[model samples]
Target chain A: MTSSKILPAMPLLAAGLVATPALAASVTITIPQVKVAEYHRPYVAGWLEPVGGGSARTVFVWYDVKKGGREPGTKWLADLRSWWRKGGNTMKLPANGVSGATRAPGSYTVPIPANLPAGQYVFKVEAARETGGRELVSVPFSVPAKGGSASGKTELGTITIR
Target chain B: MRFRTVLIAAAAASSALATPAMAHRQWLLPSTTTLAGTSEYVTVDAAVSNDLFYPDHVALDPAAVKVWAPDGSEGKVENPSKGRYRGTFDVAIDKPGTWKIGMERSMIGGTFKLNGEQWRVGGRRPPMAPGAARPSGAAPAGAAPAGAAPARAPGAPGSAGGQAGGQPMRMVASVAEIPAGATEVKLTESLSTYAIYVSADAPTKGVLTPTGKGLEFDPVTHPDALVSDEEAQFRFLVDGKPAAGVKVTLVPGGKKYREAEHAQELTTGADGMVRVKWPVAGMYWMSATTEDAKPSDKRASARRMTFGSTLEVVAP
Candidate 1:
């Protein structure tokens, strides 16, 4: 039974990759006017999720989790629950692959995977205050057999992300 | 073929059942004590109970270590030399007072699984000066000076006569004088945690003074009200210029949601002061708007002016 199941499943799994595109794909998220007061910069998280279900995979994370000596733990990563449960929760280091420094209110861009599977995908942008509220902004995009680019925006009230 | 299949299934079942139960036990370990008032070295050791249980070659995640000096100064240890399934850190202590060392371990990789835990390195009692007799005065060995009660040492034994448990060692006591006209505020008593004291007045600002060891401030933003009393007396400057009648809004950080509901909004006073009582502790982002203000002619005018500082309030 196992041999029969494996023999048929392997071809289907291999065929599933036929829809993947080989173009340089990218998604840029811009948040404008992030207000930095009291030396506290904004913490931002970016990720991609399947259109309907499954998991959210993080593509970027930015924050100053270190003070003079205090370190931010993986537990704190849970603060970005939507991203943590999807992508960060499974990786050895959340900072690896998708890490950026905490930035003042301004425009920032992240490159998406060029080899993303062709499908309807949702891009999520979530910004949290180290000392304030959380805002989750999402934009939907599609990856064709040929990869391309997509963009989105979120207004954080004196803060903007495009 | 059927017989071979049955045999393979039996072997698989036995192998699964025979798998060993493994426990990972990696903990932060530091020297028991260091001589006070000398160039004494204190070492932090990370050890695992069993080599088979060791997860990975331990390395100090530079951001995880917080070291506080006797004089209130703080510094972080960023690098750790790797040992066989362990890590060792040698630190220099140059003053007399309690030195607090705190560390957290991360489980990077391996078959054994261990969740991270914060561990303190030093004992409660300060390392006594070599050959110095216990104070001859009537005070107890660990008692604070007259008119001041000594803060309880971390991990200290419950009773005075309790058996000397292997708690982390601390340094000898040193005088922490609240500068003239400054009131001492008692923050939390946890080791390596912030214990802040400030002057009891409006526009209060003071710096921590470390006696010997260097002090480093936590860059992470603390709750805003932690520094000032609620109903803060704020001074507003727009574009580096004092502006009156400016509409201002204070936005709290995401972590500060609990306190955001209570943060007050105020207009700049005639003197550019915006006083509002803070209802909770957290980070706040204040934005002031001036209707018709133009860019200043001065070179400094081009610079954007915004207050970015963390405030911490401690118990008195």
Candidate 2:
């Protein structure tokens, strides 16, 4: 719905939306053990959202990796609210380097294509369990940037981006 | 990869069920919707109450709650504890913009039968979250609250069946989807979301960006300036525009169980906005719904789209 008041729009203090990579930057995201009774492997989605406002590019998704049939975990990707809203709704699954099976509570890394340009960008990771709890974490960084680390106290653990 | 695409298409087939719906009423009631200081924090009470505004349902933990700050970072609730009727936690607003806090997207689903029997629960857990009150109706007689000790046995309403103490909806798990002669009845997939806005200052952006993936309410007023004494308008946008003919509901909170008993229903205007007000502010929620012209491709008997949100109206 459009607002008619028509005031000068406030600029959105953009999240860490940033750059293109010159080489494949290997980033590791860790999923920590939550120690809950109903512990289900989380459906994870990570991507880079441009701070200047453009479509978000998919980084990777982790789900029930073993299922190859019709009723795979693919059905619930939308449960990852933030990612699904931005692009998961129309995303094609099993992107060669961007999709993989759900991992254990350990560190996993993916090679991010290095050709992306240098700029500020937000690296987003969202996780949702089968029992209905969900969480999202975004790390603001710049391309051709230094590596840093952040963690989600609830759903995820240390994330190291170079 | 082609095989994965087929599997994804299959999942996309049922993704319609993931669309937003009024599966349950989750309220994110905050002590105040407007915070003036960057270091100040507001207390929020989140709950899944059957009686509406009453904290008699399940309790949620602070860790399960998430807060997206105005600057696009995750905000955590501090000192989360179970209150008498709701889950209480504190959020610190370090920026001067709109912050989003609520329970993660939760789904409650089960079978509905033609035999006049039905069952459901809050979120995905069969047992209510720890420290919340027990289920009050006849259903609790069969199973114990989940996560609780096996204080009792499982059986239908006083039957002497063996106890499955921690499973609250044991019987509910058995109802078959569309049992014989149940053409009119069907399996239900209910999705729920609870988000409350805290405006530390005038919010010009990000307060009402409709995801368009589900039923969503966008505020017409500057979220930082919402006042309980005045009526405000919220728009129910479907497909990113004003949705006409949608049902908008406002239930003011004060007395226990009074909200459900005295809820008001209004239809959206030609512009898809519903004007709502609070007589006295406490913790209030607004929910809206719309029906599609055709059944979902899944051929479910009835298809509906729902949107719900928690509103913390403050005094002038």
Candidate 3:
């Protein structure tokens, strides 16, 4: 394990870290619990916006996918107005991975599809609760054509590029 | 049961009602979630009113609204108009993709109602509810009317405390102060968020992957491959691990789908996955959420998480 001859190459490897994990790009977002008086599950959505292009790749959306009716229920989606603006509202039914029900407070991993284009992209996550407030956090990561890696902070944490 | 206990308990259990118990829903009704191509136009119906059953519309300030393009470009509202319980505006899709058009994250508030009227109790004024009072940047003092106006002002701590059964008076507390022994004060602060998407030349794929936020849902399958009458499976990622027992909902897509009494609701398996039968045609939206009963810090109300998305199913 201790090859002095290859020690110098370690620096190069460190430099290349950012260019690694192209197929392994993944993120584990953690929602820290806040001790408030009132609590309700939030409406959450995450997406990837291309650096300069006009397209976005959705990570996932968790909400009351089945709680809406024509009357007063369909209106709760507005609790996450920002996500709604960014395609959260269009995801109405289940398509396997794109949408689902809300998860408990914990760390959730969003696996970047193995085949992702390389370029500058922003990993964004937004959360909103019925009585609770809303928070949107994002971090920018670069995807080298072959591989890459990077990390994020503020609502989002531990982003890995495989 | 000295009403004070209920108020304090509610505050302590802030998770009781998703928002301030009852808030008039101010919403944005979009004409279409997606556009066919670039340079397309979409209309949105917005209002700030208690339109629950009323046909009236109330106008939201045009300056308070902004339309965000797919590339994050900002557009000001145009052709602004107002009606009973509603307001309306139109914007052109400059770039191809989903556009986010909604009101700015400004606070809308009003005086807290105590026993049916704006009042105060022992040393504390009532909570100021947002989204029901004057718009942002407006003076909060004059929001109360002349006759029913509050007798005292709020914004400081350690104010003089009144006795039990104190007269109902209009008053508000500052951000720094929480009432000492409030018998009854409705917890204030309500937020309404609405999102919808459309297909602008078939949804494109990019680096839009999960960045590991608090809660996330990712498509293990190719999102674009979801088609009509096909069985698709999804996985739930909570804190980066497979989430289990989370409730996921799938609703048929259509203008009246919200009225469909028979939407599908299911839970993720132990491995954080769920299988569903895709509809034959039309658009579909899926949503899921989970919450933490115990919050982490005092600054937070409660840790609530939600997710929603849309897909296109071809006709059989």
- Best by lDDT, which number? 2
Clashes of each: 46, 19, 105
Off by over 4 Å in 1: A1-22, A34-39, A65-75, A145-162, B1-316
* Candidate 3 CAPRI category: incorrect
> Per-residue lDDT for B190-293 in model 1, tens only?
11112212111111122322222211222112221233343455554443445576555554434322432343456676766666555444434343334331
Q: Assess the local accuracy of residue B28 in candidate 1 as a C-alpha lDDT between 0 and 100.
A: 45
What is candidate 2's CA lDDT for residue A1?
A: 17
How far is B106's C-alpha from truth in model 3 (Å)?
Answer: 10
Q: After the best TM-score superposition of candidate 1, give how far the Cα of residue B133 lies from its true spot, in angstroms.
A: 60
**Model 2 lDDT per residue over B1-316, tens place:** 5544433333222222244232335566787665433556788776655456666655555566788887777888898897544688988877767888865342333343333534332222223334443433323333433433222232222111112344333233322212233323343333334567886544535645777654567768644455677788778776677888888766767656353356678899889887776677555667677765333235344345666666655443
lDDT of 3 by residue, B1-316 (tens): 4466434433322221223232333345556554433445667665433322122434444455666655656755788886644577788765655455553221112233423445332222334344334322323543433322133233322232233344423444332223333334433222222333333433443322445544566666544445465677878676677778767766553434244434578898888888878644555555555554423334334444545444444432
lDDT of model 2, residue A16: 20
Local error of candidate 2 at residue B308 (angstroms): 2.9
Q: What local lDDT score does residue A77 receive in model 1, on the 0 to 100 scale? A: 51
